[model samples]
Target: RIAWLKNYAGIDYMVPDPQNPHARVINPVLLNITQGPPNVQPRPRQNLNILDHGQWRHLVVGVTALSHANKPSVTPVKVLSDKITKIYSDIRQFAKIA
Candidate 1:
């Protein structure tokens, strides 16, 4: 699958907060897709897409928060999809040479 992210200005990324040194963000805003013949139960935490649009937008609070809130979590899926696509392409190339 393919996905995309549209930054219409006023969006920000996660950064280190000096005031709250221990308040680290543990959640990743990406969908972790896994591939295997040995499908494990319960799966890895990284293999799940848990963030909703609202939660995702809240990652960067600002005057343009509404813009973010309306947008879906596309970064993670897009990134993961690109990686998977490259893997498949590599496999295909290998098969052609073999």
Candidate 2:
């Protein structure tokens, strides 16, 4: 995965997701969670340098596959300011990114 990302998208060889980690990167939080191996963790994601420049109008995460019980959890991306309460139902669910 690292090789492919480096070759194709040109992502830096450092940690990809600062919040998550894989075999290629060690994360302190993950170590505490599993007490060891990451097999119990979410599926590791290969870095996508193509999305690097922060130019994507929409950031799409997760797979289209039937909600895999073993993959990463669907996280809520903040689409509005914290002060803005009562977001539309559809937007809060991440469906707006679609």
Name the best candidate (by TM-score).
1
Off by over 4 Å in 1: 1-74, 95-98
Highest lDDT among the candidates is held by which one? 1
Please give the CA lDDT of all the candidate structures.
Answer: 0.38, 0.33
Candidate 1: pairs in clash: 30-76
The deviation in Å at residue 65 for candidate 1 is: 26
How many residue pairs clash in model 2? 0
Candidate 2 Cα outliers beyond 4 Å, as residue runs: 14-56, 59-98
TM-score of 1: 0.22
**Could you estimate the TM-score for every candidate?**
0.22, 0.17
